[model samples]
Each structure stands twice: as structure tokens, then as C-alpha cells.
Target chain A: MKAKILYIEDNEQNLYLVTFILEKHGYEVCAATDGQEGIDMAARILPDLILLDIQLPRMDGYAVARHLRTNPNLATVPIVAVTSYAMAGDRDKALEAGCSGYIEKPINPDTFIQQVEQSLTKQEE
Target chain B: MIACLVKACMPPNITHLMGFFISLIRSASAYPFRNLSLFVVLILLCFEVPPARAEVRTVTVGVYENAPKVFTSETGKPSGIFIDIIEHIAKSERWKLRYVSGTWSEGLDRLAKGEIDLMPDVAYTADREKIFLFHKIPVLTVWSQVYARKGSRIQSILDLNGKRVAALDKTIQLETFTRLTNSFGLKIILVPVPDYKTEFTMIASGKADAGLTNRLYGLMYARKSGLEDTPVMFDPAPFYFAAGKNVSGKLPEIIDRHLSEMKINPQSVYYAAMKRWTSEEVQFKLPLWLQMLGLGLGVALVMSLAGGLILKYQVNARTGELKLINQEMEQRIDERTQALQVTNSKLQVALENLAVAKEHAEAADRMKSAFLATMSHELRTPLNSIIGFTGILLQGLGGAINEEQAKQLKMVKNSANHLLSLISDILDISKIESGQLSVFFESFNLKDSIFKVVQSVRPLAENKGLFLSVEVADDVEEFTGDVRRVEQILLNLLSNAVKFTQKGGVRVKCQRNAGNYVTSVTDSGIGINGKDIGGLFEPFHQIDTGLSRNYEGTGLGLSISKKLVELMDGTLQVDSSPGKGSTFTFTLPNVIDSV
Candidate 1:
């Protein structure tokens, strides 16, 4: 079965861009507009993988990752942080906060797909 | 005959002799015998005479203890200038001599009463002349003077006004003192001391303003007591020895012959004796050897010191002359050194100019490569779009699609327009580097320009779901400058902010700073690392090589902003930290007044 993905992002353009790339690759995608909703949706769907945007209204991506990690049912789910912050050490910070992978924005379509596939495969292992 | 008479009165043996003697007398007598006998008896009686009364001769001598001319010696011997003269006259005259030692009053008394033969030293006052006859020879002239304490304020007779004075009683000084006191209205305190020592001590102890005495005696007292000499205020009064009126008949011959002779021979027996008795002889001796030695050494030492001082002065003059020459040479060297330093600095400045030019040339070479790369990419984008759309059309991929197919084709036309904008940015940066881009300055509201920038970047921020806030500080009022360029700089910064900031917010602030209007764009987004800050404003220099592939840009925004700010006579500055945020600020001159 194809991996089920949960995408949490507040920016509509970025959400569209990420969903388009993932759906085109034959993955089932679920979306939330903010971090709180993302946390709620993840609990409900218990997706195979989760894609989180660091910058979110109401709640942030780091909070969502921590929430998913605490739930026993979704504890082992692979979470990828996607952000426009390309500063040094941003990826390490995201990973340290319980993300499986980090994707920098002005997103490269090809790299974004590759990283998402890799994070999903890592989860299987 | 008396002897015959006695014989007649005698016995019979003598009577027979007497009768025979009577008959001899009758035979020789045409003269009476009795008368002859009586005449003989008378001759005998006259020759037998009564004893003579002694001669009553008196000698007068004056005594005044304080007088220098006539004073009693320390040994109680009567000796002075006048004493000597009187002793000589007494010896020459062979008269009976007597000395009446008493006060001056007593001497005057005896001379007036004719009890004394002479007064040794008395000035002939009118009242005195009426009672006594003076000798032709004046014994001495004595100046009467005032004696005051050392450092006393009594410099002149005028200083004696209303001041107390002391004088010896029954002295000529007393008369003179009285007259001066009355004339000057001085309060004379006549202290009749027994001697000059008492009088001098009284003045020294501040008991009197001054004491009146003969000038000679005052000087003698000062010398004896080691007090300083003071001048006499009044004229000198001449004094003399005087004889009594009873002996006035012999005065002229005695005074003329004897006194005049003594005056001629002043250094004779009398004067020598007086000086010896008065101890004036001691003053004529030579000073002791120790005192002479001390004085000679002092003089020789002073002469040697003066010679040494002169030699030092000559050496100092020579040293000063050499120092002046050295200073002149040093000043010349200093001037030459300063000139050489100026030339060295000029050479350094020229070298720095060359180095800066080389850096710019290298930067231009990189920019040319970046520009060519951007140009090829920009041209290929539209060409690829156009070629794809045209190939699709040629293949009838949109066959019979009607209005929908044509509308979709117009979207490709919009994508082509976006590629044109990328080419435009490259061309603009090249124009800026070549010095071909110029700003058109005009008066405009600075806040309005900043608002335009915020509005232009707002859609992009919204697309990322990021809050965009614009704040104009109250101090930033309307200003005049190059509005279009200012807007362009602000737009570039806000665009960069929206591009990086995927969350949180982008803020544009406008404020007045110093003399300029400042605009700042802050983003809570992907911040530039500190290591990259230095190269942020260099054209075509981004933080990482792969940044261009991840984020879309020519990497010329900050360099363009900085150059544009400088052209407006402003400064562009950036502060950023990795993973935190970045703030970009630029200033424009406030040209409101000119507007």
C-alpha cells in the first residue's frame, strides 16, 4: 500500500505546491492549515508519514512533532519539517525537535520528492 | 731815752748813773731830753708793731657730674675740659685754691655770692651775667640735644609735639628744653635725675619721649651704653668759667693772657690730662689682630667669589652660543623629516588607490559572468515556454478545445512575462555597474513611498501566510528626495524578507533619524549567518553555492540597495543572525525645505 501523508502548512501556495508534488508521486495526502489542526489530523488519521511547516499560526511545527511523538499510536510515524528558513543549523534544530528530515524552501520540486520518499522508507526500516 | 726814764725810776746804784746821764743830756740839749726820750720811745713802739691778720682768698670750682667739659672722673677726681683749664690757671696765679663739689645750682650759688672765685663751666645767661663776671675765654661750646630710645619715632623736633621730655634740673639744657616745649606746645616732663645714667635709663624704658642734655655728653652716654647717637635739635650754647664781681678787676688780664694761651695750646698739659682722666685715650688704640684678620679674610673671599662668578658667566655665554647653533640644525632636520613623511603618505595613498581599482576590476569580472549566466537562463526560459506552447499547438494537442484551450495558452504568455522580469533585473544591475543607471530625484512624501513598497510586497507575504506590518513613526513626516529609487530599495528589501520568511511576520518601519528619513525592513525568517554578513552587499555573492538552486534569485539585491543608498547620500546597513531574523535599514536625506 502507498504511504499515507499528513501535510501541515499555513501558506496556501506552499501547501498547494507540496500536495501537488506528493499526490503526483502516488501518495495519499491529508492537509491541515495550522499546527494545532495538524496535530488533531495526525491523531485522527495516524498517517504513515507527516510533513510539517515550521512557521504556522495558532501552533508551530515543533509543537506538532512533539505531539505526534507523545501519542503511542503515531509515535513511530516519520515526520519531515519543511521551511523557508535556510540559515545554518536550521535542519539540525528541526531534527533535534523530533523531525525525521528537513526540506528548505523556495522548494526544489525534485529534492522535495526525494526527501519525502527517503523519510518514508526510513520509517519502514 | 725810755731806757733812761726807766733808770731814774730804778734803785740808788742806777740813780747815780741816771743823774750823770741827765747832766750829759742838759749839756747836749738845745733840744729837750724828755722829748728826745719820748721820740725814741715812740720809734721803739712803732717798730714793735701788732701781728698781721691772715689774707682772705677764695677759689671757686664748678661741679657738674653729667657735663663732658667739666666732670668728675670715675675715681672721684675733678677732671674735664674745663677742670684742666682751671687747674692750670690756679697754678699760674699762685692763688689759694678750693674746690666746692656740689650740684650745678650750688656752683652758681657760690659764684653769685662771691664765696667762690670762679665757676668752671657756666654759660653766660642774662640773669647769670647780672650776678657774676665771666672770663674772656669761653671754656667749651656744648650743643644741647634730645635723646630718645632706639627705633623711636622722634626724628625731628616736630615729633616732640605733645610728647613728654626729661631734663636735668638747674642746667642750661633745662632752659632750652622749656623754651622748645613752650614753642611747640610739648608736654615736657622735667625729671631731675641725680645723673645722666638715670636720665638715659628713663628714656630707654619709655618713661619719656626724649631726654634733654648736652650733645657731647649724650654722645658719650650713647657710646658708653652702646646706644645709637641722635642729633641735637637746637643750636649749641657756648659756656665759660666765670669769676665773682669782687674779683672782676683782674679778669681781663688773667683771662686774656692765661685762657687765650691755653686755647692756642689745646693739646698742652691741661687737655692731655683731661683726656687721660676721661678715658678718651682708649678710643685711639688699634683694633686687635683677630678683628683685623676676620675683616681681611672677608674681603679676600668676596674678591675670589666675584672672579668665579665672572668665569661662570663666560662659560655660560659660550655654551648658549653652541646650543643656538645646534637648535638651528635640529630645526632644519625636523623640517626635512616632515617633508619626507608627507611624500611617503602620498605614495601610500596612491598604492591604496591602485589596490581598490584592482578589487573593483575583479568584482566586475565576476559580475560579468553572473550577468551572462542570468542572461542565458532568462532567455532560455521564455524560449523554452514559447517553443513548448508552439509545439503543442502544432501537434493539435488543443484540438477543438474552444475558449478553454486559448485561455490556457494565455497563462503560458504570463509565464513568459515573468521570465522577462528576470532579464530586466540583470540588465539593471549591469547598468548600475557600468555607471549608466541614473536616478531622477523629486519631492515626494517619504512615508507614501515606504507605503508603496509595503503594498507591493504584501501579496507575496500573504501568499506565504505571513503577516505584513508597516509602521511609520510620527517623526517621519513628508520629505523630498529621489522617491522612485527609495521605493525601489525598500521593495527589494521587503521582497527578500517575504521570500525567506515562511512564518511569523515581515515589518516595514519608517522613521526620522538624525537629519534623514530612514526606512527599515525586518523579517522573522531565514537569517543570514554572521560569516556571510561581510559578503552580503557584494554583487553576486550569496551565503552558499547551492543557495541559488534552492532559492530563486540573482543575489544582487543588497549590493544594488547599497549603491542606490550611497547615490542618495545615505547609508544602508544590515544586522542579522542565523536562524533568528534580519533587519535591513537605509536612510534618505530629508529635503523638505528644498521642496
Candidate 2:
């Protein structure tokens, strides 16, 4: 079975690139253009992993992350933050807000799928 | 006949005797038988008549008031010791004396002019001997004695200093007192009265401090007028009977003769006269204790006066010293005040400059941080898409691509990746400079991080046909530090090694030196000159400064890596020489606290 990933990002190009990369890797990709839609869609579809962008429109990725953590159904789901907010404590901030992993932006396409798989695998543990 | 003539020129007393005898004879002729013996005796006594009686000489005497000596008595008679002696001699000589009373000076002038035959009570000096004739004998010995009002301070000759003294004018007392005081270097004011009586009057009236009078007069009259005799006495000489030079030398000789005879007799008229006049002198004596008390009081007064003078001198000296000290202290205070004011102004200027510098530095840091934030997010967001899409095209996920197209796509992906690294390096250096960069401390396997960095840089080294290698010691196992930053520093060093090496190879070695990890990256392509290596770690500095620069880089990697290592309390150093390979080593303590 194909593991599903919910990609929450405001940049359409970033969403498209990530979707294409994950779909090519034989994983089903779901899209949410904003943090709230991502959180709502994440709860409805119950995706295998959530790839969150820290800087998002409407509800921010950290708030969405914290909100998703409160729901028992989405709480066990892996939430991975893929962000360009890479200065100093951004990774710790994402983790503190209930992210399972943090990946710096301008992600290397070759390693992007591996990182997503790692978060899903972590959730499985 | 001559015998009868001589007998007829005899004295009247003898002629009167003859007259009685002749009358008796005439009476006997009338009664001859009754008076016959008396007529015979009268005729015999006529031959014994004395020669003509000596002529009675008249002497004019000058008298002045000098009591107990020669002064006019209240009975209008010339009386005193001199008068009594002169009168007795006059009686024996059968001489008539004519008294002329006047002031002492007037009498002296009368005697000088020979208008008076004699002047009494004159003190003899060699100067007076030139003008008047003095008897060989002085009638009395006298000295000038000082008299003052009762309870006056004048007690001795020296005590007459600065006093106003009254003395008789044209007298031996005034002339001799002036001489005596001149010799003693004492100054006194002389009030010359006409007589001793006036001198006593002036002193009594408080016009003079003391008076000079002969002792005979002072002793006899000083007490009568409430004047006391002072112990100051000088110029003791005999008081003589002064005669006019033109007077018969016989008169003084006769006076001298009588005085000499009278002096020896002791019971003579001279003694009788002196006793009569000076007998009024009081003979009172003070008790012994009273005299001693007066002496003690005198000594005390003298000591106190000396002490007062000494104290005044010392006070004046101390006052002068105090004034000098006060002036010096004021000057020192003024100097200290000036120095303090200068220092205060300098400190104020320094504080102001420091405040301004701090303000400028803070503002610059704020701007840098803002730029770093913008570049980190805004630039990388677009870069994420470019690198991702280009990567997708190269992989042929959409459709199969020809070799040429695939090659172009690969180039496109490489260019994008390079651009991303440039942007990332700029953001990193900016964050470090602005002090916004921070490290996270986590336990990570040291060998794992080194291998990952080596794997990522291996592809680039292979593309350049350069060998890549890594050697981490067995002891360089799991350690505590910022895992991300450690990986970043190793990747930066490895990438630099791969980029600079043309052939040969690049090597990475990690070892545990005591408690620290020493990681070194050595490259065999082109080595840097020793001089150029010094500036190699400086930001934006590259060894290639030529028009045709060979290297493609932002020249920020090594500088950023050096700064990152230093942030974790580590040191990065480079060893290289021209035409030889370069080795870059870094030492980081295994346990660094993350910020």
C-alpha cells in the first residue's frame, strides 16, 4: 500500500515540486495550501505523514502542528516540518510544537523522499 | 704845742674826758681847796688819748630766699646761717652792712656788677671762681637734692629719666644737673624757676615731676609743702660767701678769717646759727618691715615690666608666622581646585564619546539581523522550487529526455544548487556577524556526522577526477555538541578541499586529541602561498585576484567555517606552501554548550 503524505505549504511551486517528488517515489501525496486546510484535511484523510511549512498563510504551521496534536486521531500521525526558517532554534521550535522531524528548505530532491519516509517510519515505531 | 695838738686830735671819748676834767678844774678854782686831786689826774690822762678811730666801712650784702641758708626773714631782717655769721664778724670789725634783697639770679647779677658787696649761699664751681671772689672757707657744705610730690615715682638719679624737673634759674643746680644727666645719657625737661621756693611750688602743683634744690633748703622746707626728698643727689660742693671782684679784698679775707676761727670753736656763732635754722628738720625713722616691704614692691614692679615687654615681642613674632601659613594654605587649595576641575571635564567628554559609539554599533547590528532574516526565508523559498523542479526534470519523472536535453537539465540543476549555496553562505555569515547564529547541543555519533559530510562531498571530488577519503578514529565516537554545526563545518571543509583540488585527491582525518576532536582536510591540487594563506580565512577574500579568476565561489565558505568553529570555542588553522598541497585542521572541544 502507498503511504499518504499531507503537504502543507503556501508556495504553489514548493507544493508542486514536493508532490511530484513524493508521487514519483510511489507515495500518494495530498495538498493543503494553508495551515488550517492542511490540519482539517490531515484529520479527514488521516494521512501517513504531514509535511508542514513553518511560514504559512492563515493558521501558521506551529499552531496547526499544536492543534493537530490535540486531536487523538491526528495526534499519532507523523508531522514533519520542512521549512526555510533554518536559523538557530527553528528546528527545536518545530519539534516543541509537535513535529516529529525538521528538514531545512531548498531540500535536496534526491534526499527529500528519504526524509519523509524516515518520519513515517518513526511514527510506526 | 705839737703834743697839745696831737692830744686835741684824739678820739671823741678821750676829748670828752678832757672836757669833764677841765670843767672840774674850773669848778675847783671856784672851790679850789675842795677839788684839788681830781684836777691833777685829768691833766695826767690827757697824754694817754688813742689815735683817730678807724673809719667804719659799709658793706652792701645781696640776699635771696634760700631758707636755713641766706634768706630775708619775715621781720624785714637779713637772717640765716650766712646772716648770723656775717653779722657777728661785722660787729667785731665795726663794719656797717647794707642788705639788698632780690631773687637769687638778681642777686647773682648784682654781685657780678659789683653793685652788692657780697652774695651768700653760693655753690662754688671753677666757672663761678672766674667772675666772683669766694671766701677761702665755705660757710656750709651742701648738695643739690631732688624733691617730688608725695608718692611720686622719682626715687634715684636714674629714675629722673623722661621727667620734667624744676630747678632754680642761673643757679649751680640747673647747670650741674643738666651736665650730670647729659653724662648719664638721660633726657629730662627742665623748668627753670627763679628760686627753690618756686621749684617746690611747681612740683607740688603737678607741673613738674621733680625739683632740684640745695639739701639745706630741701631738708628745712620740702616737708612743709607736702614734697618728699628723693634719693637723687649730685654735685656736692661748699656754699661760699661770694663777693664782687671790685670789693675790697680785705673784706673776704676778714670774713674767711672769722669763719675759720668760728668753725674750730664749735660753740661759735656759725654752729649756733646752723643749729638754730636746721633744727626744724624732722628726725622721723621708718620701721624695718616698712622699708623691706617698699624694697620688695620695687623689685616686683621691675620684674613685671620686664615680663610684659618680653610677652609683647613673642606675640608679634607668632602673628607673623600665622599670616605666612595662612597664605600658603590658600595657594595650595586654589591649585588643587584647578586640577580637579580639569579632570572632571575630561571624564565628561570620554563618557559622551562612549555613549555615541555604543549607539551606532547597536543600530548596525539591528539592520544586519533584519537582512539575515529576509534572505533566509525569501531567497531560499524560490530556490527550493528551482532546485526541486530542475532535479525532477533531470530524473525524467515527467517524460524520457534525450542525452543533450538531460545534460542541459543537469547543468541547470547544478547552477541552481550553486546559487542556493551562495545565498545560503551570505545568510550564514550575516547571521554570525549579527550574533544571531546559535548552536544546539545534542549527542550524535562523530563518525556518522563525518561520514555523511564525506559522502556528500564525494560526488563533487569524483566529478573533478579527485580522490576523496575520511579517517575518524575509533575513539572519536559519540560526543555531545551541536551535531548540525559539526556536520556543516566538516562539509564546508570537504567541499573546499574538493573544489580546490584538480587531480591527486582530497583527504579528511578525524582524531581524538585528549578531550578534543581534531579534524583535518588535506587537498593535493593547488597549494596556497604562505603569505596568501593568512588572508584566506578572511570573509570574501580569495587567492585568485586576477582578471581571469579561475575559481567559482563567493569566498565565504572558509571564513564562515572558521567563524562557526570559533563560535563553539574551537580554532581553525591552515598549513600550506606554494606548489605543495594544503592541510586545514580544526580543533573543537567535545563538550561545548549550545546557545
Candidate 3:
């Protein structure tokens, strides 16, 4: 079976970009437009990895990370926070809120797959 | 003489005669012949002496115009100190005093001729002592003084030379004056007056320039007669109750006895008599030492009172001056306090204005930070899509593309990347200026960081056919610093080198020197002018505005690199010459002591 990923993002273009990139890499791409939908989908599908956008509507990525961590079904899954807040301390903030990894916004397509794979491999280890 | 004899001899003779009679009668029976003779003699003596005690002796006391001492009073009765004492004695002695009023000279003459039995106020003199008898105790002490007309210049005996001076006729004062002037060789003419009144009247009328008289009479009448008493005084004498030498009476002796008895007692009639007759100044008649002591005490009291008044005046003056000075000082203090208050108020206003300005600046800084954050998100979100889609297309992930289309798409992707980097540089400088940029420190390899930067720019250098070389000393291998920021600085320097050099080569050198990591990037390219070197590190500064078209750049790379190097406690410096090349070197401390 293909490794499953859930992408939580508010912007449709960011969601499409991440989905296309992950799908082309042979990972099954699942979509959630908001933090709450991402959490529900994460618990139900029990995805192999979660790609989270920090600036989400209604609920943010950090809250979604903490919520997803609380569900036993999704607790072991890796949650990676992708954010446009490239200023100091943003990565630490995302990771402290239960994200397993952090990536800055305007994601470089060249490194995005590698970063996600690193998180999945880290979770498996 | 007969009265004296009777008075002296009668009392004893009578007592002896009676006693002999009784004794003879009792012894007649035993010795008849001798007893008969004694008895007859006793009886005859008793019969011969009449009743002497039964008869009162009459005394004729002479009074005169001499006042206070003996003159008759206004009531027409003989009333004077002399009569007062004499009557007191007369009452006790059972004697009748007969008053014979006369002039002083007449009284003296009467007493001398035995017409008056006693005369009072007689100053004893050798000439009078021949004619009158005086007792041992004196009635009073008197002195003679010269009296002159009120405005006359006769103040002493020397002033009496060639001047007519009047004196009482036959008086001791007159006799003494005559002898005194004559002995001094003064040719003063003499005017004899009958009494003190006449002498004073002659001097007052200017008949004589001055006159000699007893002090008692002068003190009494000189001022009334418009006369001044001169200081020329003489003849201090004792006055007595006097009698004619031939007069047979014990009046002078009796007066002496009474006066002597009165003198011993302070509360006696003698003191009363002196007080009544003499002026108040002479009444108390204190001892000489007592008078001196009283005068001394009086002088001391007056002097102390004067000194106390002066001290009090000076103290008051000083206190007034002190009060004025204190008031002035208080006023100055008040003025100073007011000035300080004004300054304090001004300072408070300035402080308030500064606080308000600070608050406004802080608010504006907060808004700018918010705007930077929002721009980072908004600008990058669309760029994220463009770069992602273009990158996906260039990779032929969706479909195969022709070579020409792929080349054009690569160009578009390159332009998009430049735009993204421009946005990123703008964001970085903004973060630096806003003091929001922070570098993370870790143990990183210096050579690896430089190798990675050189690798990123290697393809660009190969496309331009420029030789790129890197030399990192063996000791410059590992350093504890911000790995990401170090790589960023190296990448900016290498890319700048590759971009500028069209034909020549670029070289990078890293070495450890003085506990610092010194890295230099040197390029051989179209050189920079000396004038442009100074502004090379300023943000958005370009060497040649026309060259900006030929070279696509953000114009912020060198400035960002310089600032980043400075943030790591390092220095960035450059050297260049026209038509030659430029060298940019920076040094970072090998060990960061503090963040």
C-alpha cells in the first residue's frame, strides 16, 4: 500500500501544490481545508503522515497538531508544520505544539518531498 | 554771793544743828557744863537760818533776736530751743525763769553786768570769758562765714582786699576777721554793725562788699536779704549758756549737766532741740564715715543704672538688626523655592512630551512588524504557487514538453526565483532594521559551509566560463556559529563573485587568524571605482546605474552580507580599483564569548 498523507491548508493553491507534489511521488494525498477537518480526517484515515499549514482558518496548525496528538489512532503519525512565518522562533513554536517537523512557506519543490520523507522515516524509526 | 552761800551751806548746817541739839539735851544730865554750851549754840544756828527750801530761786534768763536757739516766738511767749531746755530744767529744780528779751549785744552786756542771770547762744571767747562764765558742755557748735551781695565777686579772703567788709561789733567773728586780714597784709576797710541783721543788710545794700557772720544766722537770712554766702569761713566755736562772772547762780552748771545727760541718748530732748532749731541738712548730723559710705553707695547705684540702660539699648539695636537680616534671608529662600518650582514644572512637561513620543514610536514599530509578517505571508503565498507549478512543469511531472517550451519555461522559472529572492531580501533587511532577525548558533564545519555555497554558485561560474577556486585552511574546519547564516553569507559572496566576473575568475579563502575565522572573496571582473567602494555596503546601492540593466540584482546582497557578518561579531571590509578587481573580506570570532 502507498504511504498515506493528509495536507491541512487554508489556501486552495497551497493544498493543490502539496497534493500534486506528494501524489507524483506515489504517496496517497488526502486534503483538509481547515484545522478541524484535518483533525477529523487524520483520526478517521489514520494517515501515515500529516502536512500542516500554520495559517489555517478557524483552527491553526499548532492546535491541529496538539489535537491530532491526543487521538490514539493518529498519535504515532508524523505531523509536519509548513508555515510562511520564516522569522525567528516560528519553527520552535510549531514543534513545541506537538509537530514532529517544521518547514518554511514558499516551499521549494526541490526539497519539499525530501523534508516530508525525512519526517515519515523518523516516525517509522 | 549771799544766795550762793545760803544755797551751799544752809542744808548741811541745819541738819547738823538739829542733831547736835538732840544729842546735847540727852547728855546734859551726865556732863552739865559742856552740854549747856553746845545746846545753846545749836538752838541759835537753827533760828538764824531761814526756810531755804521753802523759797524758790528766781532766774532771769536773757533771750535775744538770735533765732531758733533763743529768740521769742510769734505768740509773744519766750519760745525757743534754749527756753525749752531751760524750762525743763527749771521745772525739776524749782526755779523761776524771768525772760529778758534783748539784742544779742545787749544780752551779752546785760549778762556781763549781772542784770540777767543767764544768757544763751554765747560763743565763748577769751575777751568774753573775762566778763562771763561758761560751762564745760557747749550748747551748739557754730562757724562764721562771709556773706556777699548776690552778684558780688567776694568769694574768698583774697577777694576782700581793698573791699569794705561788715561785721557785728564786739563779736568774736569780727575780731577774727580783723586779725586774719591784717595778718595777711590785706587793706580791707571795716564796717562795724550792731548785729547779724545789720551786717547782712550792709552787705546786701552794697555798703560792704562782704560781711562776716555766724553760719546759723547767715543760713537763716542770707537768701532773704539777697546775699550769697562766701566760701571764706572761720571761727568754729562752741556756744554756751553764759553768766556774768559776778552773778551768784548755778544756771550754767545746771545747763551743762542737762546737756551732757541728753547727749548720750539718741532719743533725748537735746536731739529734739537740735532737730527743731537747725536746718534739715544739719539735723541728723551723722558721723563722717557714715556720710562717706552713703555718698559712695549712692554714686555706685547711679553708675550701675546708667550702665544697665546703655546695655539694654545696645541689645535692642542688635536684635532689631538680626530680625531684619532674618527677614531678608527668608525672602531670598522663598524666591529660590519659587524658581526651583518653575524649573521642576518645565522638566515635568519635557518628560511628559518625551514619554508621549516614545509611546507613538513604539506603536509605529509594532505596526511595521505586523505589516512585515503579513507581507511575508501574502506575497509568498502566490509566489509559492507560481514557483511550485513552474517547477512541476519543468520537471515534466505532468507531461513531456518540447525542448523550446522547456527552455522558455526554465527562463520563466528563473525569473520567478529572482522575484522570490528579491522579496526575501526585502523581508530580510526589514527584519534586520526592525531588530527581529536572529541567528542560531551551533557547531558547524566552516569548510562544509563554504563548500556548499561554492557548489550552489559553481554552475553559474561554469556557464560564464570563470575559474572559481576555494581555499580553507585545515585549522578553519569547525566553528561554533549559526550554520544557516554562515552559509547565507558565503552564498551571497560567491554568487556576487560569479555574477560580476564575465571572463576572469573568483577566489575564496578561509583561514584562522588571532582566534578569528577570516574569510575573503576576491573577484576579477569589470572593476569598481574608488568612489563606489565607500558606498558598497549601503543597502540598495549599485555601482553603475546603467549596469543595473545588464545585471539583474536586488542591490541588497552586499549590504545584507555585511550586516550579517557584523551580527556574528565580525567585520566586513572591501578593496577595489578601477579596471581591476574587488576583494571583500570578513572576519568572525572563532569562539563567541557572548550572544
Q: Give the per-residue lDDT of model 3 (tens digit) for B232-270.
A: 999897888888787775667767766776787788777
Candidate 1, residue B280: Cα displacement in angstroms equals 6.5
Question: Between the candidate structures 1 and 3, which one is better when assessed by lDDT?
Answer: 3
Off by over 4 Å in 3: B1-279, B282-333, B463-465, B474-478, B526-555, B590-595
For candidate 1, write residues B293-367 as lDDT tens digits: 878887888888887888889889988988998898899899999988999899899889989988999788767
Q: In candidate 2, list every pair of residues with a backbone clash.
A: B28-B32
- Candidate 2 versus the native: TM-score? 0.58
DockQ of each: 0.01, 0.60, 0.50
> Candidates' TM-scores?
0.31, 0.58, 0.59
Ranking by DockQ: 2, 3, 1
Error of 3 at A34 (Å): 1.5
Model 1 interface DockQ: 0.01
- Candidate 3 lDDT tens digits, A17-118: 889988999999999899888888987888999889998888878888889889988778888888887887787789899988888878888788899889
lDDT of 2 at B542: 77
* Model 3 chain B weakest 10-residue run by lDDT: B13-22
DockQ result, candidate 2: 0.60
